[model samples]
Target chain A: MKYAYYPGCSLESSAKEYDLSIRACCQYAGVDLIEVPDWICCGASSAHATSHLLSIALPAKTLVQTEKMGLHQIIAPCIACLTRLKVADMEMEEHGDLKKDVETVLESTYKGSVRVRNILDVFLNDVGLEKIEKTVTTPLTGLKVACYYGCLLTRPPHIAQFDDVENPHSMDDLMRAIGAETVDWSFKTDCCGVSMSLAETDVALELTNKVLEGARDAGADCVAVACPLCQSNLDLRQKAIGNKFGVFYDMPILYFSQLMGLAFGATTTDVGLEKVIVNPFPVLGAI
Target chain B: MRNKLEEAKNIMKVAVKEDTTAFAKEIQRKCGQDVLTCYQCRKCTMGCPMAFRMETKVNELMRAIQLGLRDEVLSADTMWWCVSCETCATRCPQGIEIVEVMDVLRETAIKEDYYIPVESIEAFHKVFLRSVEAYGRLYEMGFAMDLNLMLKDPLKDADLGPVMMAKGKLKLRPHKVKDLKSVKKLFENVRKLEESRV
Candidate 1:
């Protein structure tokens, strides 16, 4: 199976492990992800927060490329990027003038035909769990994980609709398929304070603290995530959150892709496991 | 805790400061969310994770907009505090797309220069857009530096820089698109569109 890929800004930078593992997982699934050539930024939180037209137009520029590639679906690993692309595509369809405006802005015609999906959607629907189950060489039998969706994965119900808006389980189900024990937790769809991370660091830290505590309380060994923002907030800032709250959580916040890679016969180094901030090796070693 | 009754009285008193639907109509035109259909269930407020940080509750903000309380709504730091998690939008029985409403409010506040956001939120968005306009994708290094300059802090994230660098996570260069001319043109067209809307 072939699909278009938008690595997004974070995937190429801070969230490189996500990119590495997602690519590794897709390769094992026999799914070829062709990068959308000359694809621009998806306009992320910044575009949507400031300019409505810019939000639609910037992502539309990327969607226009997907359209030009004649691909039906584009895999945006970053949930924010996926949402932006999905929002832009939906806006173009919902509002006729907006589509014309985007066309005029980008100086390119967009068919609004690309289905913007996260990598989870690709694995869950396209590649099927049974196939993935059959391919698992290393069953994550002892690994107990809290599947954290964060936000934008199943939110803004009018747009970016993927799974249950409040209680999504695609990630959990995927974890189970790979032989990992999925813990039921309330903070699965909670916000990791998002863009406020850089600005209001404490607030983000507090939210991250809650998620980590919740996962731990619910008997999860580690937290599995889909979005880069969620990973950075929960993983990158764990120690900081610990420092502020005075409660150290050695909990590992791992990308679901990395876990999938681990089960799909890839080495820990190949999936970039050692790159996580909280040192997942300590926890994964016991498994 | 402060008296809820007194706060409600103050909110109402400030809300009547401007009784014009023109602002409401403009919001309807610009944001395109069905805020008028709100029955004040406060589900949005209840679902909002950042509600504690917001001066105006999410549902109250929607109600204020509906009642044309432009000044009260715009000057409030509620929109700035919004994390855009969309839990409010997701759980709203009215299907009001509250996150979109918050976006328009922030955009309006910035454009009209009504209430300057004290937080580094404005600087963050500006730097993010500038990075995209320049490189077609966010350049983390440049974004961090530009953010520092805008926030009047040269070495704010200086410590985290080295940590990120050692991990081999921070890409030194910005992500660039081949058709940068198109990206420039897109920004130009958006500016023109905004001017026309104004």
Candidate 2:
């Protein structure tokens, strides 16, 4: 299967491992990812918070470019990017006036033809679970994983319209297909305090602490995530969370794709496993 | 009994109000979210993760919008604290999409040049957009540098720099898209449209 890949900003920077692992996993699953040429940022939280028009227009520009490339489906690994792109597409399809405004800003008509899918969706739905199971060279047996959906992935149900917003099970199913134990946790769709991590570190730390503590309480060996922001906050800020809360949590936060890559026999370096803040080698070695 | 009645009368004094539908109308015009649909249900507030940190809760903000309390809503730190988790929007029985409402309020606050209670969030937004405007994508190092400079704390997150570098996560240079001029033009067109709306 072939699809266009829009590896938003975080993939190339803070969440490079996500990009690496996602590509590796897709390749192993026999999926071809053609990167969108000269794709711009999706104008994430800042654009939406600042200007309503710009937020829609920003993603519209990229979607229009994808149409120009003649790709009908695109996989945006970052949950936030998928959310922004999907929302823009939905708005333009639903409102002709907004579509005209966006077309005017982008100087191109958005056909609303491109289907935006997150990586989790690409794996679970696009590539059948049975097919993925057949490709697993190393079954992650006995390794308990807390599958964190965070927000934006399946939220505001009308816009995302993916898995069950409250209790998403796609990631869990994907993990199970790879032979990993998926733990049932309450904070599956909780907020990770994303941009707040940069603005208000304290609040973001508190939210991240809750997610990490929840995973730990449920006896998860490590946390598996699908969003760049979730991985960044949960992985990078664990130290600060520990120092602030006077609790030691050495839990490793990993992208779901990385775990799949591991099961597909990809090396740690191949998937950028060493890039994580907390070392995951111990847990990976155990299984 | 007379004294208690007088005290109660003083506490219950009411004032005449002016028409305040303009705030709600403005929100509707901007994002098409109708705050009138909200029936004082606290579901949004209950589901909001940042409600505890907000000066005004999600339901309170909806009430402020309905009442056209422009000054009260604009000056409050609630909108800035919202992470746009969409939990409120997901749980809202009215289907008001409180997240979009918050976005509209934030845009209005910025347009009116209200005193932003959370300067850090405003600063972060500015730096983030500036980075994307210059380069097609966000330059992590440049963004951090610019944010630190704007916040006047160059060494704020300095400790994480080396660690990130070691992991090969920090990019020393930004990748500018080939058709950057088009991106610039898009920004200009949007800016012009925003100005025209105002």
Give the CA lDDT, 0 to 100, for residue A122 in model 1: 84
Give per-model TM-scores: 0.94, 0.95
- The predictions' CA RMSDs to the true structure, in order, are 5.0, 3.1
lDDT of 1 by residue, A1-287 (tens): 88999998888888889999999999999999999987788888888888889998988888888888889889999989888888888879989998998888888898767888878888999999999999899999989999999888888766765888878999999999999999988898888896888867777887888888999999999999989888877777766876798989889989999999999989887788877877888778855
Among residues 3 or more apart in sequence or in different chains, the pairs in candidate 1 whose N, CA or C atoms overlap within 3 Å are none
Best by lDDT: 2
Q: B100-171 in candidate 2: lDDT tens per residue?
A: 888988888898899999999999999999999999788889998889889888888788899999998999
- The best candidate by TM-score is 2
- Lowest lDDT sum, 10 consecutive residues, model 2 chain B, at B11-20
Candidate 1 residues B12-34, lDDT tens each?
88877666567767877887766
Ten residues in sequence with the least summed lDDT for candidate 1 chain B: B15-24
Report lDDT (Cα) of residue B29, candidate 1: 84
